[model samples]
Target: MMTVPSKLQSVNLNLWYGAFWALKGVSMAIRPQAITAIIGPSGCGKSTLLRCFNRMNDLTRSVRTDGQVLLDGQDIYASGYELTRLRKRVGMVFQRPNPFPLNVFDNVAYGPRVHGVRDRRTLERIVESSLKATALWEALQNRLDRPALALSAEQQQRLCISRLLAVEPEVLLMDEPCSALDPVATQHIEELMRELMQRYTIVIVTHNMQQAARISDETGFMLLGELVEFGTTKTIFTNPRDKRTEEYVTGRYG
Candidate 1:
């Protein structure tokens, strides 16, 4: 059997905030149609790595990057590549659930509209399908006209996800998506992730080890700014390659 190419790859990646290096020579290949979780203590460059996938860090005034990030074998940082298109292809969800003050329907339709989707029927179908895919259709079905900010935090987060799905991104980068949710809501999001991995390539930055163990196929452990170990979730949690990974995962140190 022939193996498929990686969906995303980084080679000798380094990110700098002015002169301070945030990510130091980090590199990895993410398999397509799988969930890869980046786990580490706070300020360990987990989120920075996720931003590099779609070049989100470019928005920061002091940020500079060296090395290459390839998506489907193409270098995204090369000249003539449109950052707007790149970002649309690689969607992101932040730590908190931030829904707009607009109505629920418009919130999910925001991306499509900005991308020039104008037909009422087309937008409706996209909204319904996207919400259904995130498992929020039933709860949000009747209240499409209500403001998105009125929903619970978890619902709002799911709405944000639905918005991303509306655009049909090939890759999803989630930075601590479930951190603010309660246990029940967190479980729902976790279940949603498993379902999502069947279709979209996902890279998640998480602090919860059990959540990583439950959801990820591959786990990357980072410390300070270095990737200490990266392997199958079982190996990282049970038998890590690096001593630092073993200590961090086993609750010996952060």
Candidate 2:
């Protein structure tokens, strides 16, 4: 039988901000419907690599990169690539929850609305299904008309997830999604990630070792803009082949 490659893969990617390199030839595969965690200290290129998957660095005027990021076997950076379509298929969640000033219903419906889904019935269906998928439907069921910012911090983060879900993305990129959340809020997001993994490929950048250990199916460790190790999460956490990964995970040094 022929084995199919993963849905997302980075091949020998090198990124730089003008004269300074932020990631150097880092390569890894992200399986479909699985959570892949990128872990390391600050300025270690974990977040930088996450941004590469969706071409988020293009917004940075000084940024430049060489190599390929493949999505479903297609090179996203290739000439004639449709950035709008790419972004629609790959959604992003930032370290902090940033909802629009609109109400909860509008916030969750924004993506579909922008995509020309103007029918009230269809938008309602999308909003309900998306919020339900993120486990936020029960909490916000009665507050659909309330301002998104009126929710608690934890609710706000879940609302953020719901907002992303509304777009029906194929891959979800999370940059420390729980960093600004409390323990309870973080737990909610973790549970949401688990549910989300059944349908979306996920890549998360997290500094919290425990969070990575708990949620990731695969893990990659980076330092000084280079990938040092990539493997199953259990192996990366327990018996990493690279000394740098061992030290960073074991609390020896960041």
Candidate 3:
């Protein structure tokens, strides 16, 4: 059998905000074109680790990092690595829908525009295809001129994802992407994620273990900045090698 290469990886990755350590020696492989869910209680460094993949943590003040975060086996933190290109290849969606305060067409066109795509027809195609990919085109194609903020919460979230898709990212880093929506909306978003994993590598940090079990192909359990176990979702939840992972998955403790 041939082993699939990791889309992204962290080796001995550590992070600190001022004097507080947020992630400690976390190392794991994220498979391509699949969903990898990181689950733990609040403040377990799951979000921090997700941000490291696209170097989003660098925006925070008083932050320090060590070790390697690799994309396609190349260290993303290497000196002179182009962050713009890195972010283009690895996009992010936040806990809340954060569409730009712009019309739907422009919101989806934002990334391509920033990357120097100025042709009107090209932008139109990108917007249409991106929205279609996120399952929003059918509903919003006629409302391309409408303000993104006026859409329903789920629509806004899907639009945010469309915005990322417009950039043609290879890996998507989602930090609680469904926490802001109702259960029905969350289900829709989960289904969208399942569809997206067919073409993009998805790494999601979720507080809901059930969500993780439902969508992720691989799951990693983090605890207070440490990864206690990482494996197939079935093994991690049903037959976890670590007692802590079993306990957490069983609702014994967060």
* Highest-scoring model, lDDT: 3
Cα RMSD to the true fold for all candidates: 1.2, 1.4, 0.9
TM-score of each: 0.98, 0.97, 0.99
lDDT of 3 by residue, 1-254 (tens): 02999999999999999999999999999899999999999999999999999999999999999999999999999999999999999999999999989999999999999999999999999999999998999999899999999999999999999999999999999999999999999999999999999999999999999999999999999999998899999899899999989999999998
lDDT of each: 0.93, 0.92, 0.96
Task: List candidate 1 stretches off by more than 4 Å.
Answer: none
Off by over 4 Å in 3: none
lDDT for 157 (candidate 3): 97
Query: Of the candidates shown, which would achieve the greatest TM-score relative to the real structure?
Result: 3
In angstroms, the error of model 2 at 12 is 0.6
* Tens-digit per-residue lDDT, 168-222, candidate 2: 9999999999999989879878988998899999999999999999999999999
Cα RMSD (Å) between model 1 and the true structure? 1.2
Question: Residue-wise lDDT of candidate 1 within 104-129, one digit each (tens)?
Answer: 99999999998999999999999999
The lDDT, on a scale of 0 to 1, for candidate 1 is 0.93
- Cα displacement (angstroms), candidate 2, residue 172, comes to 0.5
Of the candidates numbered 2 and 3, which has the greater TM-score value? 3
Residue 60's lDDT in candidate 3:
97
